[model samples]
Target: MSNKVILVVLDGLNYQVARDCMGYLNGLIEQKKATLYPIQCELPSMSRPLYECILTGVPPVLSGIVNNQIVRLSNEESIFSLAKSQGKVTAAAAYHWVSELYNRAPYDAVRDRFTDDETLNIQHGRFYHWDHYPDEALFLDAESLRQQFNPDFLLIHPMNIDDAGHKHGLDSRQYRNSARAADIYLSNYISTWVDAGYQVMVTSDHGMNDDLSHGGILPEEREVPLFVIGDTFTHAETTVKQTELCGLCCQLLGLEHCKPYAPEMIAL
Candidate 1:
C-alpha cells in the first residue's frame, strides 16, 4: 500500500533563521511531535539547480541544471514522474519553474499557471510566477488541491522567504519576519495534515547569504533546515543529505527510488 506525503520547500531559507524564527515548528520539536535535522544543500546552492537536486536526487554537476537560468524539462527521473509512473497521483503548488521542469517547458503563464491534466508528470499544479507571491495564498492553494485531488504526493513550495532574503539580506528584519509568517501559516495547516495521515517534510532549496544572494560556498548559502513529521522516521541523531530527499519521498510513497540515495537520511 502507498502512503501520502507532502514536501514543503521554503525557498531560500537559511538554517539559522529557520532554527530561530519558525516558532511553531520549533514548538513541535520541543513537544517531540516533530524532528529537526539541519542539512547542507547541494551546490552551487542556487534555487533552480537545487530544486532539481532535491526532487531528482541528482547533483547540479550531473543533472546539468547548474543555474537558475537553465530553463528546460528535467532529463532525470523525478519524484513526480516516479509517482505518476507507479499509478499514483502527484501535485504541486510551487514556483512556475517546477511546472517548466516537470509538466511543460518554456512556461506560458496564461496556459500553464493552473494545470490538472492527468497525462502530465505533475498531474495537478498551482504554479505562481511572482517571486513575492504571498506564502499564505500558496498554502491555501495547496490545501485546496489536497481536498480536491488527494494526490499521493504533494509539493507545497513558498517563495516569499527567498524574496525577502534577496531584497533585504539574510540578517534583515524583513527576512526574519518572512520566516515567522510562514511558520504561522504552517501551524494552521500542519495539524490537520498530520491527522489526515500525511507524512510531511518542510525544508529549503538553499540558504541565503548576508550579501543578499546565494549560489556560493558560504555556509549561509549551503546550510538549511529539515523538519520531519511522520512515524517512519527513527528520530535518531544521524546525518542527512539534501539529495537523499528524493529517495525519502519515494520511501514514503512506496515507490522505488530512481537514483542513488543515502539510506541513513530517513533511517527507515
Candidate 2:
C-alpha cells in the first residue's frame, strides 16, 4: 500500500473561517501538498450526516443519518472497510459513533475508544463533552494510538469548534477564535505524521451559520474546506463534491473505491 494516511476532521469549519483563521495551512499549500476545495455539505449538516458524507461519500438523504447517536450505518461501503480489504491497518480517534462503525473485527488491540476524563484518563481535561471531544485531547489520544498501532489509515475528529458554534453563535468571537485554535492544533499534529513519512488530510464535517446551527442549505453552513498535504503526492482540486472524499481517500491508499461510487475526479 501507499504510505500511511492520516485524515483529520476539523468539525464544523467554514471555508471563509478556514481562509482567515488557518494561516498555518498555507505552509502545506506552498509545498503543493495542500489543495483547498470548496464544498457544501449535505442538508442536515450535523456531525453524523456530514461525517457519513466524508466517510461513505454519500449524502444524508441517502445515507439516512439523521442524528449523531444513531449507530446503524446505511448498507453502504466505508473507507475503513475498504482499507481492511487492502490489508491496511486502520485506526480512528473520534466520537462514540466512530468506535461503533470501526470496532474490533480487523482492528488491533491498540484500537479502542477514549474518554476525555482528565485524571483517570491519559490527557483530556475534565471539561470534555459526551458527544464531541476537543482536538487538543484527541490529538494526544491519536498520538498514543499511532505510536502503538502504527496504523496504515487513521481517522481523527476534533470537535470543540462544533461545540463552540452550538453554544455560541458562529458570528460570536468564540467561534472565530476557536476556529483559529483548531487550525493551529491541526497544523501541529499533522506535521508529526508528515515528518514520519505519512500523508495528511484535513477537512470538516459541515459549516455553521451566524445562528450557530446547521441542517439548512445556506452557503455559510454548507460550505467547508478540504486540504490534502503530502510530499509524495501533491495536487490541486479547484472544485469537488463532498461525497467524493471517501473514494479519494481510498485512491490515495492505493485501493479501489466501492463499485458504482467513484469520487468525482478533479482535472489537475
Regions more than 4 Å wrong, model 2: 30-33, 104-132, 232-234, 259-268
Off by over 4 Å in 1: 262-268
Model 1 agreement with the true structure over 87-132: per-residue lDDT tens digits: 9999999999999899899999999999999999999999999998
- After best superposition, candidate 2 residue 216: deviation in angstroms? 0.5
Local accuracy of candidate 2 as per-residue lDDT tens digits, 106-200:
22223334433212211221122364555677777788777876777778788888788888877888888888887777767677888876777
Name every residue pair that clashes in candidate 1: none
lDDT of prediction 2: 0.70
Q: What is the lDDT of residue 215 in candidate 1?
A: 92
Global lDDT scores for all candidate models:
0.92, 0.70
Give RMSD (Å) of candidate 2 vs. truth.
5.8
